[model samples]
Target: MSDHLPVLKVRLFGGFSASYGEIPVSFGRNTTTKAMKLLQILLYHGDTGISRDKLLDELYGREELADAANNLRVTAHRLKKIIVDAGLPSHNYINIKKGIYRWDAPMPTEVDAHQFVILSKDVQACTDKVKKLALLKKICLMYSGEFLPELSGDEWVLVESVHYKNIYSESLQELCKLLIERGDYEEALRFCEPACQLYPFDEWQSVRIDCYMALNRYKDAVQEYENTAKLFFEELGIRPSEHMMQQFEQMSSRLNYKPQELGDIKERLKDDDVRGGAFYCSLPSFRDSYRLVSRIIERNGQSVYLMLCSITNGKGMPMDKPDKLEALSGELLNTIQQCLRKGDSFTKYSPSQFLILLVGTNKENCSMIFDRIQRYFSREHKSWKQYLDYFVSSVAEVDRQDSPIQFNTENKTW
Candidate 1:
């Protein structure tokens, strides 16, 4: 058996990185280059060894290279130099026996993705529950993020990433179940919270909520549920899944029955005293207020309008840079707050956009409100200039109960 790379621990999850014991091995500045990609593919395939033809397809996908095989040879040659040049004692590095290319180093390498698979299989075979639980926890920890996330868009990386992620999700779920069954909810969170941050949209948030509920952390459970629901709405434009809703349903019942004094409850529910200007809120709160207003307008015969405000570069382009958007967003926020009244409410929809709810305002009045915002933006935000786009929707007309509201999108740039 060949000796392994001396304490070489390769990390393919989250990002591609390697360490020889405590010292790091650099893959150079640009990880997306073809040479690095060749290295990654060979390392991922490991002992199974990717066939030469398969490597060709993965390396160059249908761009009509004149000599594709020759190109791959050059890439592999460069990869060898990079590995040796990065201070690793070199051997052949990439070995091909009868056209099956493998990572042929002097010694074996400990890759996180491979180690995760090995441990997961061990967990499955483990008869002792305690040992199995420990293995499962290690499996969850090993998958810090998706495999080669920076290269996730590539076809080979995408397939492998998905496979790694599926294993991670299943392993984490199993670990949490074991912990919850054993009444070790705190220990479960030590694994689940990091997973939540890495895969927020993947329903690991549900696992976190489960941990919170198991520990009798009713408030934390409710807060996590609400935050997860809002994240789903804002980012995915979808509601939480049925399973997630079921989890929240269990927590919601707990949320309602809290023992508290009536005075204390009132104090908790009370908002800060009126400070004038539009009541700025989060997108979720804006959604709630918008729904409440829609219901009330039918009975009160009052006009309500929904306006979308967007900040953009001139010539109808978007201002997307972080530094520029921060300055422009702040200026636009100030302009909207200063121009709108106390009755109106606005929420930031994104860094470059806001949703404004103008109550008791007609079509013409909506225009007038926008005019005020535009004038203020032009005057105060002159040095930091950005164009504004505002779209107004009449709430009554939108909710008229005449037919389903097929929104005539009123997007306009001011």
Candidate 2:
């Protein structure tokens, strides 16, 4: 054969060597365990030189150094021969220059683990929201299983495996949030499915509940909460958090309860003072609210009304970084909750859209509350200048008895 294609591709994320293409390539006879480990270590290190001492510590840890070094040399030699026989570039797979061993490959090769790290860094640097979302989607597609599913027992492999798993979970959460903001609830639900499988935490489950509620799938939302509640109780012998319980109640209210009782439900919605507002606030769709308001008036029942004001030039703040965003959101919610009375409720309709149900409060009181919110945000800007900006639009009130809940930029008075 005048022209022979390359035979093998070695992936070192989990452990040593193999080709996984249309036609698989195998390393020829007599590859020992130690030899394979040496190859794996080099691939895992990837272009970095591992010091002789470090290598010994990693491979033999507390064992006699003299014996380990001798064994390592023999293994490296055997690996070099295997590399050469496999019809792959083998020149400097392992080099000993001044007592340090380095892998210097002449040609670039594909390694899933290496590619994943590069992609993750790129995703972080992306400024465009849509582009960042797309890059994350691609990165997720690349994950078939854990970094190295076959090397579960290996210590080094386990470390890398956990690292990749965390990245995958974070990326999925970000994607779900993005989809939710775009009003793509179905897609958000799909993303949360696999994420909940991996994390099994209350956060992902909560997100799933939000998506279902957004889609107006009340039954599904209730079922998911029940299932998650059971899982928490059985697995950890604990009750669902107070916040989770409220969400469940709000969701159930939408299905069986009458809108006339909306006045009474407000008290339950009051959130903690430190946080901005109620954790779960349900706002009917614009069209649905129009019909709902009419029904309330026909029945001669009063409705606690809320309106969303657009925030001009308001780009959603970067809350994607796990630790920072979670803390900030918690604080904001607490503040919102503190501002309202026992009977008031608030729901996050969209990333930037919030619906506040001011129970027994008239337009004048709502204006005062709006002014307070403006001041709060203004103060937040001074301290967190780089992070916060004045993006909020005007806040107005909707007359629950006569007018439908809609947004208007023109009328400043309610």
Clashes (N, CA, C under 3 Å) per candidate: 3, 22
Q: In candidate 2, what are the lDDT values of residues 249-354, reduced to their tens digit?
A: 7796788756575444345345423332343444444335444554665566554446442222223443333443333344445445544554556555444345
After TM-score superposition, the amount by which residue 72's alpha carbon in candidate 2 deviates from its true location, in angstroms, is: 0.9
The list of candidate 1 runs beyond 4 A from truth reads 1-5, 246-253, 257-414
Model 2 ranges with Cα > 4 A deviation: 1-22, 25-33, 62-66, 81-92, 104-107, 149-162, 240-242, 257-414
TM-scores, one per candidate: 0.60, 0.53
Question: Whose TM-score is greatest here?
Answer: 1
Query: What lDDT score goes with residue 374 in model 1?
Result: 71
lDDT of each: 0.75, 0.58
Scored by lDDT, the top model is 1
